[model samples]
Target: MAVRQRVVAGDEVTHVVLDREWKVIAPIEDYLEYLRQEQYSPHTVRSYAGGLASWWTLLEQRGQDWRHVGVDDLARFARRLRDRGSDPTVLALRPSKPAATSTVGSAVTAVLGFYRYHAIVGGVPAARQFYVHVTGGTMQSRSQYASFLGHIGGGQDRRVIGRRRGPSTPAPLLSPQQIAVIKDDAARFEDGNWLGDLRFRLLWSLLEETGVRIAEALLMRHRDWQPGTGTTAFIEVEPREDLRRRLRVKNQHFRRIYVGDELDDLYGEYLFLLAEHGFQFDDDDPIFINFYRGQIGRPLRAETVYDWIEGFKRRHPLLPAEWTPHWFRHFHATALLLAGIPPHVVQRRLGHQDINTLMRTYAHVTDDAEMRAAADWKMLIQRWGAAA
Candidate 1:
């Protein structure tokens, strides 16, 4: 259960495990290797590994062996997860409240996945026995049976995982007023500190205007910026890997976002400043660099951006709790939807492969639109009747 940090080759740091007693309960190393082989992101690998650790710790407390675990054991673990606040390891750090449903579900799913993997590879038949074979003419008929891992059935149904959890609370977006205030504050930078100011302003404007995720924006390279046919410029978001930096896109989907002449001009200034700072202009040089004292010209990292936001919050005590870069994305999406742009177009603009995802996330906007349409239709009928 001990989390240890190790420096791998090329001076890169990776979160690795220390030899702990919990390894007896689970093949932690092997599972992590398997995930690595499957190209799972480092974040995902850490999460799954942590889930397995928590499961093993809980089972150890209950004096139960994973090989002999049953459905009842998993149910009890789920109950414990729902009742406990925070991660099991960090429970003593703060007062415990019930964990969120999504968190509980993920823990359960992780445990189930572990067992399923071990059941097939470790030759433990009891692991497969933990699932209850769902049957009958109900909607589950297509499923061979329900196991903790997922549904097991014939054809495509076989080896499917558990049902996905329902949507949680909607993510909050920044009001236009709030955004304007933030922009005004950022604009206060003068002669001595213009670099940081311009960089942040352009970053915020790009997020507000184009709605690309922060990661997508940060990973952009000089060559990714293209000159459009007219006065506009475009930023291409491509799934890329930087092994030294341990950076990559989430889903590897390619999409283009067009920027107006103003943003393009702002970027041109930023590029000029970057060159003045002695940064490289190579094709692969990150458009956004870490301007902090020692790391100039190096690519920016997530932690730095987070720290910047946190510092801004400290400066503006009245800033909303939900005011983050992601909130800007939500604001952009809602603005587009309410502006009468087709949902499909907005989906493509946002680089969402699934329209259902777009609709579900912004259902509130669409619901309001539907209500307005309904009112207009009612008014039309009433006017026609009066004329008759």
Candidate 2:
């Protein structure tokens, strides 16, 4: 697949690249259009587009034009990638960056999808039977490795992942004190200091209050938030189907979340601001305006929220501000849960597709739980006896 760079509208370059099967050569713009027409979120569009970009780059390296590549070529390419020490398991995870086994699978999938699309659209002869090869994820790799170990020792595979209190390894989250400090500092910024300061507040609020991915938050439109429905917070956190075929609205579910008190003032102020700007609070207009750049009134992108978080880190000195925007989500979920909210409730609030997500994310916060439990063990035993 030749990644031919052509300017679509003066200096705005569009890359025309081939998919894995070397069948469908498409300009990323076309796919983006397809995604938009399908009502896919911008984040999904960017992610798929990015994965496709990598496939095109791989195809370019192999000197295979997408118009002429076949199943054998993709298989050979896969072998070549594997020989280069690309872990099959890492490829499976499709991690974004930095993680050791991140992103190779997406690259593979991009090419496969490209080929699949081309075959369906009459761009190439039928070859789907051979082109689609699934990659390995961490869990699959672990199980395989464990099985191999058992085979070697002639014993049962006995590894057990128990949910005692926490995961063996957990990502760091911001402490409440640190989060409070971050919030205070963010609030102290005088209005009008930044172009999208108000919008930033909304973004932060959602991350802190709802524990949603910033990408999910960016995908939200005005129509998604409903006015009072008999005092229940009228909000629907719909997954952007186009951002990617897989939508993990916090890996829990695509569902509604009550904004409740935490987001009430912010929502009210935002409503007034949206009205003041002459924009209708309708379903079409994006809830978060992309005002950081010259693209005023345009809907915000996932990257835009990332930029604000980056900026927030630069401005806040009172807190351990190195935490990423994602940490806000970690802070929110654990905080909501620790504050006596049920896991199911938090899952719904965060729009998580599953309860396992909540478990996996906050499983790291067990040190405090253990300490509290230890302190109580002696007290209850002595005061309330065995029942306590």
Best by lDDT: 1
lDDT of each: 0.71, 0.57
* Predicted structure with the largest TM-score when compared to the true one: 1
Tens-digit lDDT track of model 2 for 107-220: 455555555555555545423433322233122222232222333544332222111232256666887677766566555435743234566666777777777776667667
lDDT string, candidate 1, 1-388, tens digits: 4343333667443444443452333375666667777777766666676666667666656677667876666666776777672333444655667767777777776677676667667865555545544444233332134334443442222222343466655658998888877766665446754624667777888888999888878888889987555656898999876655667666678888888887787778788777776876788888778776447667887677778788888888887854778899999999999999999999999988799999989988988898888889878899899999
What's the TM-score of each model vs. the native? Answer: 0.81, 0.58
Residue 157 of model 2 has an lDDT of 28
Q: How high a TM-score does candidate 2 get?
A: 0.58
Worst 10 residues of 2 by lDDT: 158-167
